[model samples]
Target: MSVTDRPVPSHDRIARAAFPRRRVLQAGLAAAAGAAVLQTTAPAEAAMRREGWIRSRIARMSVEQQVGQLFVMRVYGNDATASDNRNMNEYGVASPAEIVAKYHLGGVIYFAWADNLPTPAAGARLSNGLQRAALAAPGKVAVPLTISTDQETGIVARMPDPATVFPGAMALGAGRDPELTHDTYEITGAELRAVGVNNDYAPLGDVNVNPANPVIGVRSFSADPALVAELLVAGVNGLQSQQVSATAKHFPGHGDTDVDSHTGFPVIHHTREEWETIDAPPFRAAVEAGIDAIMTAHINVPALDPSGDPATLSKPIITDILRGELGFTGVVVTDSLGMAGVREKYGDAEVAIRAVEAGVDQLLNTPAADVQYNAVLDAVRSGRISRRRLDESLVRILGMKYDRGLHRDPFVDESAVDEIVGNATHKARAQEIADQTITLLRDDADLVPLPAGEVLVTGYGDTTTVNLAASLSDHGHPAQAFVTGSSPSQTLINSAVTRSAAAAVTVVLTYGADTNTAQQQLVQALRDAGRKVVVVAVRNPYDIAGLGDTPTYLATYSWLSVSTEALAKVLAGEIPAAGRLPVSIPSQADPDTELFGFGAGMDN
Candidate 1:
């Protein structure tokens, strides 16, 4: 059945069906006791008792406290050590303790530089310290802060060494197994939770149609909208099943644009029809699958709002398109307001005020927290921003915190941190997923599973060449390594060819060679030197177009160590290449012709 045609059961019915009879009876008994109290208690006490805990907490919050609940501040520090706190002045940002005490911040987001501690124990301590600070802050109602990070596995991971570095979104799509995708995210969720993180900004929903897209390259799952939607839903289920809130990001789609929103505004000129077919489906699927948050993109879509306001500040895009039309009632969050796409045009105060008015539930990662907090307070007090609207966002933000069980216990077990993060089972699963995602695009010469012989491996430095060479050696295939950086000179290419002259086969690894003429020249020189060349794209699969009709070609979609090991095993015939191309590969002969369509993989 189509997604739209699926039946959506009523909430009451679902609740009744999901709860056991004994649990239902317990609820009934509580309701009866509450009714008895209603009859005996004073009117105000009865009202407080009748209202839900979340609403009751909101009723008592001061205006400043209520406004503070909407902001998720960015903090900087390598760990929660006292020395790190003393060094906060270096970054010119307030310490976590001061920010929580002054602003009553709703959430905290960690970046690579801030949270990349040497061990999982340090990370857990940092998270615990942040939670303690938030709860102790002077406020009418002390709510636990939502701690989050970009733990999106591949290139965007914040915790690398201590966390299981799984293959990225494109690899998940190439594997074509939603169950594996779900399991991969489940393991990620567990690790994040182990360190006291309750939210993960992951599972990119953008359909990567443009190969040259700078930001959302391999971050996206597939170019096909339906495929992206399916994998996005699976990823959401995986995350939420582990009690971590998963975010579907850069919404209203940031896939087709060439400009990175980090530095400049990207404009998507698609009409409404095109958006419905290409961009809107994955978001719609996410909402239907019960995604906890939908992050607004900074890109401007002319069709959605002709005023040219980026979606982060455009009411038409966030309120009308996402909330009204798409029916995403979950928390609406803004991408980092500090990005040049939004920050360049508006001041911090104006950005915060306009984003709330635009229906954003959470204002994320603004450098100037004081300016934003005071601006929002002023707007609400002056009646420029409605109290009702403020309350609406507060409820959603607090609801997520409550659902995450933060109210009961906000701290993680620091002792268990080492036991959970990067465990043996999760690491093995990471390798399994990487093995499943290695695609063999071209093997016309049947050079793969090359008989045990001397092999020459040339690639981008130690991470790619050294690991691949060791894996080949593990499989009884002795291999030599040639480490060439992105821009390889002709002399290096000559050295590679001469070294491979006596070898049985030459394996060349590329990182986005499709756009680099120097790398293409190196590959062409290898082919011309009568070497049996097998080009493996370690990063971008589009590099296949650069090497014209190479006898054997493969794509690993990532340069992670596990991915490198998987590729080596595939080359040594220990495992078959099972992954298909998630995106199309343009032909070298005709730039307009696609040499390999989506889901194209060769096992033999």
Candidate 2:
């Protein structure tokens, strides 16, 4: 029979079947037998009731269905169209509906491709269709799926337009206001929930200590563990308050490594003491703050586990360290298993089995869900992994789903998506965060609050640069733009220099100039040409050291439109540079020498 043709089970029926009165009575009687001796604890009785329900549900599930509950597969949101369906089927990728119906997946994660719907209404319709499929799957105990996305506000946002874009974590940290951080995440959660995403992989707790760290640069809150912890907890509260699960990610810290775990395993040699001091504090705080989930990092910490296994597949790390030492009772989810860090070492099947045995409750983004599911089922049948162990994770997963109220109403209101997403208030709050987070690192020439005169804006012609020019012009500064590539050709630089000669002040925008020599050279050439240059590191603050004697420097931390507007306001003296550096800036001559400390920002 087709999955769609199957009869759907009512929520009450599933609930009653999951927690049978007979079993509940049996457990209650046993508890009551000891009630006089133990003084009848309501909490204990409630726990027993929950355990009975989970056990009854597992007892009713087929092996395949039970194993499927452990996997959260990635699905395309664009699969509602015939063309997308054809392409997905040709590529052997199942539609979101098909995956939920066939595999009975525990959850679905929306990627950028899936989330590129025409509007919030379209996204809501797609999400509702997927949930309906899960509900219609042929099963006695059909549970609703947990829908999720990487809606981390700035660069990592998966949901397309109509979702307000806030500054990244580093910029939030620069703002140095926990209340603002909470409100930002609360809005992020509300928008995601409006579009039917229940889980958010965000508030990255990594304390980015290594300036050269490629992947986690601006995604992290700060280099200081204490500050990151304070802000991370606020972020957690905000998301949970909005009825979305917040995941404190890259467990035990992925911030110090130079290698990208997406491609390879980065080894951190920090001892237990070192880790406790630097890498573990944010996670510890997250556990205490009641973070819903903790995503494991693919990097290997030798001190934590001598087996050289990454935390995603290490029992000692996930179970002993996070669960035991930190006392985190929430779900433990794996980073994507498709990443080379895990895939290259262990095949999909082995990785799934190992992750389960290592105490990971959810297997995320596996290369092939069917293969992993079958492999886990085979392990269970062969006694390689006990069904009891499987049940442990299943209980937690189901408990979270129930707690999220998915069973009662998994679908979102399609009309509400448009109403809640990117509303006026959210956009204003985003602009406010951007305005407050502009850090003035260097202003030796007192070039800011420029006297009424013509201004030259030159950059790679990115969105941020275009917005900056428009914002300046709007603020009555006659601004002319000199556009260039991210790595501008000499001709472009020369042209910009010639254009700058006519303006009272030259504003050169840079992205990753600390690493990109071309960006550094362009700034140097403008300086050498004797243009009064004010450099803004739009992406990374590390560019300050690379600009080579620029008279003025500022850190916008991101290139979002709001950030660009804020930059214009700060430059025009309409808004004070109130933000501080979240991470220290290293000297160009000596990497060890601190050129600017973490709280260093000046306001005129």
Give the best candidate by lDDT. 1
- In model 2, which range of ten residues has the least summed lDDT? 1-10
lDDT of 1 at 582: 85
lDDT of each: 0.82, 0.81
In Å, residue 27's CA in model 2 sits off its true spot by 37
lDDT of candidate 1 over 1-604, digit per residue (tens): 0011112223333233323355323457789788767656877774464337678778888898888888887666645434455235533344666666577778888776764355677778888888888777664477788888888877788875768988899988888777778988999999989888889998899999988888998899988887788788878888888888999998899989989999999999889999999899888888877889989899999998998788999999999989999898889889998898887668889999999999999999876776888999999999999999998998888788776778789899999988899999999989999999999888887798775579888867676798888888888889888887788988887788788887888888898898888788878888888878888888778987877777789888898888988888898888988888888877767768998887788884
Question: Could you tell me how far off, in angstroms, the CA of residue 522 lies in candidate 2 after the best superposition?
Answer: 0.8
Clashing pairs in 2: 77-114
In candidate 2, which residue ranges exceed 4 Å CA deviation?
Answer: 1-53, 79-94, 115-118
Q: To one decimal, what is the Cα RMSD in angstroms of model 2 from the true structure?
A: 10.4
lDDT of 2 by residue, 12-101 (tens): 432332235643334576676875555457777867876676677778888777888888887665543323553265335546676666
Off by over 4 Å in 1: 1-51, 78-94, 588-591
